[model samples]
Target: MTQGVMSGAGCACQPVEAVTAETFARSWSGVSALAWRVPLLAWALLVVAWSGASFWGPPEMWFLYMTHWGLLFILLEMVFGVIVAAVKTPEKNPDEESGLPWYVRVYWLLYNITIPVAFLITIFYWCILKPASKNTHVNYAPNPVLDVMLHGVNSVAMLVELALSRHPSRLLDVVQPWVFASVYMFFTLIYFFAGGLDPWGNAFIYPVVDWSKPEQTAVVITLTGLFLTLMHLATIGLASLRDRLIRRCRRDSAGVYNEGFTA
Candidate 1:
């Protein structure tokens, strides 16, 4: 039931069936698997190093933040992606879409959740958090480098992966991200009640997320959930557009080859 099955018309909007092992192992560009694996490996290492350094520095409390959690997701996604491409075996019939391997499905699930959440973290920080911090004279970003890496590079990497990966986006995948967001909101409530503090020693994790102001916090959560839904929809649309463009290009190229051969 979870398998992506295309209709007779090859509708790009339908969830795609599990693809070939090679497709899972390589990029949409048809590049060598090493070409895909090496970059992911390097970035994974970088994420590990940065995370270690961040923890080692002052105010380790920042680890409690959602941006850092997003970083963790990025690292996990890359590591699992490398493993899948390296060790995943082909199905009995390469042409058939029985279903993805369990690990492959997990990796796809991470990709779906990670990408939009990364963007959400970035958007919320720069647009909402940073501006509010400015007026309050609070320093949300203690380190400029870490600031850009977490808020900027995370989303950029997700964008690059989106363009390169062969995996199809499922509209149903949005539920996974929504559930993840709900978990984090629940955590915030617990953290607040338990007397957790932001790095600056405030009672709330973020200035805008004041538990004492329940109405404001509720509005923030509701808006954030809506934005996440929109982001996932946008992700699906991008994948569909990429598929349509690739199919059109292949058809045109095949037509050109046939015309030349017959002439």
Candidate 2:
């Protein structure tokens, strides 16, 4: 009787092993098909488009122009390559869906590509454009649209990753607020001191401080710096609170899975 029970258990385990192996083989074969190839081709087209536009287009349209075009390209690639392809054949197992979503994969690819492009644009602006325009006395204002778009996307991405990843330790939760505050304070002091000296222009592109009088400029710079510092702190605090709430919601939903499985 003991030998018969052991044989029955062995038979049950063998089918599971066979099923897993078969599923893996099928998934691998599907992955080996056009999934990656289509994305690669689209990415190549994006590189060509961006390079051509930068090389041929006017200097004024360089940064934002290229960035916008690159984003559009990646968006299209995601829709066609990842979403369309994945939907054509859905995986039956929920465990397979636990991996990254199509949107996240596309976002990461775009982010990776954007980093190099941003570096190149910075080099071009500083090395070539700035020096050429320096003697011409052209006061170029920073593009507020580009700044907001880039930073906003980055912040959203960070929030998404934090939500999806497993729960953070208490240390990370505590350190996050302090790190943000300290960096904000450090930059606030630097901006205050630098603005007081030149008051007419900022360290980067535009000047917010009035430089007509030394005493007045110092006062304006100090006040502006304090305002910006407070703004940064508020932004950080709100974002941290929102993220914590989102994480708690995800944790609560995850708790249902185990109970349902047992029931």
Candidate 3:
């Protein structure tokens, strides 16, 4: 009878109701729990095994490298998040007050933000930095399996959880990334002045941070900071987009039209 309605559609063509945020969240509550726990369990198993087999007797300071530190942060986040989710899921209420102190909350934020950072770091290193530095770098044979699991899968699982799970809100506290980046920036400065030697035998952990060329190092730092900021914003935007896209898709499949959405 109507352009949007099927010719054989009877009274079943009544207007469809819009799915609100709360409804969407409730629908995915069980999914969110499973999504986070699954990857977290995998991360714990892989890292623990990797540490035991490969890092049993390595230099203690080798743990200070950003890549290693990032892994630790990611692991901590997963473990703690799973434990807390067991106690009470975020789907319960994101704004709900936790009796925990401010420092603990800060820890949560860092790990949450670290997920995308970890992924972006690996992407930059493998896709661009590694290629450009090959001429000036020494070649070494390493296990590609663990490398992908660490660099690629670690980052991706976190994001997958985000896409599959529903957050209370799409607007994350945007300032959290700045704080996380600042703390690491402070660490880099400490390593620089303290004569910290990286596992690579260089004074700087990252090749880009090598101080021999002041001009290049400065450019690297500035560009890196900019990139981090941009990425943080991009991830936040993705959260919003993911929420809107999923909702719109569900509504369309159900023959529902959202007033806020346009074809």
Best by TM-score: 1
RMSD of each: 6.7, 15.7, 9.3
Rank by lDDT (best first): 1, 3, 2
Model 2 vs truth, CA RMSD: 15.7
lDDT of 2: 0.35
What's the count of clashing pairs in each model shown? 2, 0, 0
**Count of backbone collisions in candidate 1:** 2
Where does the lowest 10-residue lDDT sum fall in candidate 2?
254-263
* Model 1, span 133-228: residue lDDT tens: 886646757678878887988888888777777666766668889988998889999999999877667788777888989999999999999999
Measured against the true structure, the TM-scores of the candidates, in listed sequence, are 0.82, 0.26, 0.70
List model 2 lDDT by residue over 186-250, tens digit each: 54445555652222233322222224345754664465445434433433344345434643655
Alpha carbon deviation, residue 181, candidate 3 (Å): 2.6
What C-alpha lDDT values do all the predictions have? 0.71, 0.35, 0.55
Lowest-sum lDDT 10-residue window in model 3: 254-263
Model 2 misplaced stretches (Cα beyond 4 Å): 1-205, 210-212, 250-263
**Which prediction has more favorable TM-score, 2 or 3?**
3
Show model 1 residue runs off by greater than 4 Å. 1-18, 32-34, 55-60, 90-98, 252-263
Highest lDDT: give the candidate number. Answer: 1
lDDT of 2 at 45: 59
